[model samples]
Target: MQGIIDRQLDVLIYPEIGMDPMSVQLASLRLAPVQVATWGHPETTGLPTIDYYLSAEELEPPRAQENYTEQLITLPNLGCFYRPWGGEAIRLDLGKLGIDPRSPLLLCPGMPFKYARQHDWVFAEIARRLGRCQFVFFIPEVTNLAEALRRRLEAVFAQYGLNFDEYVIFIPWLNGPAFDGLLERADVFLDTIGFSGFNTAMQAVEQGSPIVTREGRFLRGRLASGILKRIGLQELIAGSEEDYISLAVKLIRDGEYRDRVRKRIETERHVLFEDMAPIRALENFLAKVAN
Candidate 1:
C-alpha cells in the first residue's frame, strides 16, 4: 500500500480483486484517490474503498445499481475492443471423436463449477424433449470434478427415464484448431446458467454457431446475453430456465430458423469485433474521473 502511495498514481483500476485474498485486502485500503473496479470477476467488491464499478451498458440490466456497493459506471457496447478470432481449424472426423453426426450436438463448455445443481435438470429435460440429442462437455484438468458433475447429472437424467450416458459425452479439452473445429461442429452453444462464458461465447459467435443464454440478474451471468444483444441476436437470450431450454430446442429443431440465425450472425457479428467506441468511452471516463 505504501509503495502505491509513494508512486502517486493518477488513478488505480483494479480487476479480479475477488479472485485473490491479498488483492481484496489491498483494495480495502485507500491506495488511490480514484479506485475503480471492473468485471474480471464480475461482482461487486463489497468494499467501501471501491469508488466505482465499471461495467458495460449492455451487460447490466435495468436498475443494476442495487446489486453493487460502489457507484456504477456503464461503458458502451460490451466495454472493450475485441478482435475477431480467426484460425485454421484442424479437421477432425466426428465419428472418430465419438460424436454422431446424426444427433444434434449441443456444446456446454463452461467449467464444471459453473454448472449449478438446480440447473442440471435443464439438460435432462432438453434431452427428453429432443428425444435424441448429444450434450457435449469438456473434461476439466481435474478429472474428479467432471466425475462429480457427471454423477449429479446422471441422477437428474434418471428421473426423466433417460440414461445419462446415452445423451451426454465428455471429451478431453482441445486447443486452438482442434477446439475451433469442435465449435464449428456444434449445433448450439449452451451458455452456463448463473455464470456465463464470455470468451468461449465470443469464440462460438466467431464460428457462427447459434447460442442460448439466460440473461442473469448479476453481471457474471449476463455476459453472453450482452454479446447477443449487441449483435442483434436477442432472440437467442432467454429470461427463465424454461425459456433457455425452449430456445436451445428451437435452435436445434427449426432448420430454417437456425439457418437464418447463422446468416444474421455471420453478417452482424462484425459489430462485436474490433469496436473502438467502448475504448474511447473508457478513456473519457478515466480522464473525467482522474481530474
Candidate 2:
C-alpha cells in the first residue's frame, strides 16, 4: 500500500481478487483514485473502493449492472486480444489411451469444481439419449477433487441405469498438441453450465469442434456463449438445461449437422482471434478514467 501510494498511480486495475487473499485486502483499500475489476475470476468484487467493473459487450446480459457493486463498463466483443494456441495437433491412438475408438467422444473440459451437482444429470441424460456415446473429462491439478467429482457423477449415472465407467472416462491433463487433438477428436464439446470456459471454448472453436453451451446468468457463465454469439452460432447456446442436453445429443447423433456447425466455425471463427476492438476500447476507457 505504501509503495502504491508513493508511486502516485492514477488507476489500479485489479484482476482475480477472489483468487488471492492479500489482493482482496489491498483492493478493499483506496490505493488509487480509480480502481477497476475485471473478469479474471469473473465475479463481482463487491468492494466499495472498486469504482468500475470491466466486462465485455458479449459477456453480459440485459441490465447486467444489477449484478455488480462497481459500475459496469461493458467493452466491445469478448474484451481481450487473444492469440490462438499455435500447436501442432497430433492425433493419438484412442486404444492406447484406454478409450474405445468406436464410441463417439463428447469433451467436457472444465475443472471438476465447475461441474455443479445440479447439472450432473446432464451427462447421464446425454448417455441415455445416445447409448454408445462416451464423455471425456480431464483430471485437473486437484486430483482428489476430480476423483470425488467422478464418484458423484457415477451416482447420478447409476440413477439412470447407466454404467458411469462405460460412458465416462477421466484422463490425465493434457497440454499443447494433445489437448488440441482431443478437441479435434471430440464429436461435441460440452461447456460447463454454471461457469463457462473462455480459453477452452476459444480453442474448441479454433479446432472447429461443435460446442454446446448454456449462456449463463452472469459473465462467469456466459463466456463460451459470448464466443458463439460473436460467431453467429446462437443455436449452439442453450437457454435452459433441457436445451443444453438436446443440443449435445443433436451434435452427437447428427454427424451431418455437427459437420455443418464445424464448417461454420471454421468460416466465422477468424473474427474471434487477434481482436483489437477490446484493446482500443480499454485504451479509450483508461484515458477517460485518467482525466
Per-candidate Cα lDDT values, in order, are 0.92, 0.92
TM-score, candidate number 1: 0.96
Clashes (backbone N, CA, C under 3 Å), per candidate, total 0, 0
Alpha-carbon TM-score of each model against the true structure: 0.96, 0.98
Instruction: Give the distance in Å from residue 174's predicted Cα in candidate 2 to where it truly belongs.
Output: 0.3
Q: Weakest 10 consecutive residues, lDDT, candidate 1?
A: 83-92
**At residue 160, what lDDT does model 1 achieve?**
92
User: What RMSD, rounded to one decimal, does every model reach?
Assistant: 1.3, 0.9
| Candidate 1 segments exceeding 4 Å error | none
Which candidate number maximizes TM-score? 2
lDDT, candidate 1, residue 244? 98
Kindly report which residue pairs in candidate 1 clash with one another: none
